[model samples]
Target: MAGYPQWHTASEQGPRARNADAVSAYAAAGAPGITFALADGVGDDPGAGRAAQTAAAAAARTPVADGPVTAILNAQQALRKLGGTGDAVLVVAMPFTGGYRIAWVGDARAYGWDGSMIRKLTEDHTMAEYFRTRRQPYSPRMEHVVTTSVRTTTAPEIGTTEVVGGGLLLTSDGVHKVLPPATIDGILADPSRAAATLVSTAIAMGGHDNATALFVEPPEVDVAAIVTEPFPTAA
Candidate 1:
């Protein structure tokens, strides 16, 4: 069997009274790849933490045979079944043959690190982003107002991207929002310690929200070898 890509995760409650972020990863059943999921609960909601936990677990465990987008949709359905005012933002990443696919909603983000620099892979689903994309001025408060969430009755507009090379990262807003891109790049410079460092540093830098990070190193061997069945081609 071939070795799979290495992965690590770290999460911290920071100064918040309660943590409302979740992270999960799982090997694809009967497939050659793995899936990573992260979710951030909407702090104002009473059931935010539970929603984040449910979304992250469901997204990570969903079969990747249908792709990361479908996995996120499945997670949304799971959140609906939970039936409450609970809401969360989510991001999912899955590696394929020579690249990987990422899907996200709200502000939980995906990033790629290529040793030299780190680049954001998913866009924030917030009013700030919407206004920025339209070249309109917006208040700073808009940044905190996400346009959609896991519990939306209507399907939210999900952000997705496919990329080649480099390591992958999934982060809750607590980490990314507190750290500058250059700071994040510097931490990722040491992939082995990236996850733990990211969470700790975010808290140190005055991040009061729960912080979470998941890092996946580029595969050292073909991911297909990890499974008994022939590797399925990514759609």
Candidate 2:
């Protein structure tokens, strides 16, 4: 692979009772692969944050060959094994050829910011998304209920896309739910500060839950080195 994976991971408690969100990133040693994961514990359930942390750790520690979906499955199963009090949404990302692959459940999401555009990679497993797809009237209350998640479940939505010059982001609803796409698109100014900026923005926008973001800056090839230089004329 010509590119490397660089990551900046961050999280915040927001203005909520507890930080129910977790994020993780790992780069394969001597390999062009990287793995990233984020989870948001269902606030209604006690010990939700613990489940989210467990899922994040499992997903991030997954072997490269096991793949993204497998990692998520591990996370889901791991949480189930813990016998925790709350369920959670799990989102995992990994390098895939020229682009990246994302596997997710529930409302937490993955996004690609390639400088000029901000692309949403995963569809929320919430009623809002369900209604949007069917072109039905969506009630605001429906947003509170997630149709799918890592509640001892195996199914997850998977997406793939080449990265934008900027990078990739995995976010919990605490951040995505509040910040408009334009605001996120505008903040691509610095990927290094993106995680903190996103968390801060979500708080400023009205922090309702624990916010989290994991950023993956794709490796770049030196264009100057790739371009051929003219041969110097013999003196």
Candidate 3:
């Protein structure tokens, strides 16, 4: 099974009472390999959830052999099928024998944690990021400011990276906002128990939207140290 361990959790609270995020993945130990995808909808948009669902499902349905570009295109096509312009941002992770491939668009993010430190893997397409780079104040309100998303005329900016040996984490804005990155990194370092606690922590810390976290421990992992038993299917 490559000794990889993964955990996912989501919660809705504080602001957007309705969770507009969706996640889907197909992972196997042997032949086909591991593939994971997550999408988060713009909170203000009523149809964002549908767009996310459409995109995530599309990405997950594509052939496991497809590369990042092809997988993303397939997801875009799926959004089109739902009459969605792709107003949702998506993050995808596919684990192979050597490592994993990561691709993303919009604001949903991917984070990586080595044994000691955590690194952000994806850039956000939000205005706050622009402000941060320009040395300007980023109002908390700017969280709602999205520069790009899945839309008919707009092509999302895509970035791809390879994760060779590290813990990869993916999340919607809800999870990141409520939890500090260092805290998130610690959880990824020891994801088993922390994965479930994170969900509750977000909700407790005023998760004003749908909170989601996907933790992936790639090949060569010490599974015995993480997953002790099967994740509760109902959760």
Candidate 4:
């Protein structure tokens, strides 16, 4: 690999939501490359925490030859067998030969940063997106609901994209839903505390759900404080 990625992460439970979200990043001796997994539990039970924890650990330890889909599918099965009854949004990223393999279920997402532009690589399984794709009117109430999740029989979509030369970001919906892409891009421009900024900003903005953010680009973070700039007043 010409360029190896450096990684950083930030995850926090939303005090208001009874957060069951979990996140893990690891590199094992025999694994092809490092692995990153993020899971947001959807229910209010002990199983929710178990579901997220199981998925994150299983996904990070998947064999390099098993492939991303198999890894996640296996994770889901493991969760069920272990009596994890809660549903969750799961996203995994692992280094491949030249790029990275990404797979996700529900609304958890993976985004690529090709130095200049940030590209979303996953389509959310939500009703709002469904109506938007068809150019139909839909209520905002449907926006936060996911049509599919890690516990569903549906398969996660897997994609291979370059990350060695640029950057890769994975986030739970809580963070992305609260922070706009433009705002994210500004924070990412300075890799120093990128993940922390995302999580902190989301919570500051009243994100009611657990928030998590991970970045696969590495550097010595600057100790400078990120000042809050004023936004344009509404018309």
Candidate 5:
């Protein structure tokens, strides 16, 4: 079996009166990998913090054998069961043999850092991104408005991707929004303090919202062992 990847996470309420972000990571029981999940609650909702905590915990508990997409859908269901006026964006990453799988809803983001460059792995589900992709003009306010969230009445259109190589990063808008991509790349260059530095820097740079970051070093995969392992039986 392959060893679990090393990871670190940091979160701060920042300038916000309260924090509405949650993050979790653990070794997946059903697969030879680790699962990382994060949630950013909608600022306008009163129950946002609890909602984020619930969703992130639910997502992280999902077995990796089921895949990242299933992990996100499970989280959405969990939020609905909570039954409150709370909403949150979510991102889940699961690392496998040669690459990793990521799934997200709303604006929480995932990125790949290959030492020299940082690449965005998930697309924002915000109105601004929607307009930009369609080549339509939109107000700056649209940038903060997400089209869907974990508490939405309808199922969200989850964004997913698979990438090979490099380290992984997951962050709430508080971190990525305040810090430019170049600055993020610079912080990631040193993996030891990357997560803590990312959150602290965001706060120093006008943290109007909560900041959270989770960083994972690439796992050393034993490909031959993975190939020989027995498939998990149906539950």
Candidate 6:
């Protein structure tokens, strides 16, 4: 393994955002690789915000299971074990031996950047889409309102994806709803000032919700190799 995982994590309770709908994490020290998770609580439910916090921290504390798929399943199962009372979305990722495993549920998103291009790793699950299928008008609510989450009932339906060679970003809907894809790309590109800029922008944009972000940049593999390798065995 090479490149170290350096991250900038930050969150802010926005001006109009009543509840802190977001929770985040950076690379944990002396833990199972670099694991990060983020969650956005649905404001409609009273216990939703707390659910987000509980889910995010629980997910982060959990180790990477047999695989990404297993991890997602495990997280959903874990949330079910807890009294997850409201709708929420969670995103988790870790740098593995060969690549990275990224998984998500509900709407919180994961984004990846390979120096030039930034791509979204998760999709939104909402009834609005069903309405859209019927040629209905799109009605938007608080970005934190989610149709799916870790509730007290059934387990969460999750999604997973894999990526190699790039930096990763995780955020709640508050940030995505306020900024466009291009804007997110610009912010993540500047690793040095990305987190501060992101939180500031969300706050300035009338923060209608608690906005949080966890940006992870993988270090250069060659440099890590140079630092670790004992000797130049061959050319």
Deviation (Å) of 207 in candidate 4: 1.2
Residue-wise C-alpha lDDT for candidate 3, range 64-113, written one tens digit per residue: 56776566788777777777443677888765545667887777888877
lDDT of 2: 0.73
Per-candidate TM equals 0.91, 0.84, 0.80, 0.84, 0.89, 0.77
lDDT of 2 by residue, 77-151 (tens): 788789856778888876655566667878889888776567887878888879989999999878868887776
| Candidate order, TM-score descending | 1, 5, 2, 4, 3, 6
Runs with alpha carbons beyond 4 Å of true place in candidate 2: 1-4, 28-32, 44-46, 156-166, 221-235
The model with the greater TM-score, 1 or 2, is 1
lDDT of 4 by residue, 1-235 (tens): 2323566788777764466777876555544456678888877567787788788777767765666677688777878888736767788876664456777777888888876667888887688988989999989867888887777745634433334436788998889999999888888887758888989899999988888898877322311111212211100
- Put the candidates in lDDT order, highest first: 1, 5, 2, 4, 3, 6
Q: Per-model C-alpha lDDT, please?
A: 0.82, 0.73, 0.67, 0.72, 0.81, 0.64
What does candidate 6's lDDT look like per residue over 15-131, in tens digits? 543463555443333444555678777664556766676667666655554444444455556556765445567777765654568777777888888876678877775666546
Worst 10 residues of 1 by lDDT: 226-235
lDDT of 5 by residue, 1-235 (tens): 3444567789999877689999976554445665789999998355899889888888877877788888878888888889877888999887666777888989999999887778999889999999999999999889899987877624437888987887889999999999999999889888889999999999999978899999887656632124223322110
User: Can you write out model 1's per-residue Cα lDDT over 61-114, one digit (the tens) per residue?
Assistant: 777677777877888888889988788999988767676788888999988888
- Candidate 5: how many backbone clashes? 0
In model 2, residue pairs whose N, Cα or C atoms come closer than 3 Å (at least 3 residues apart or on different chains), thus clashing, are 114-164
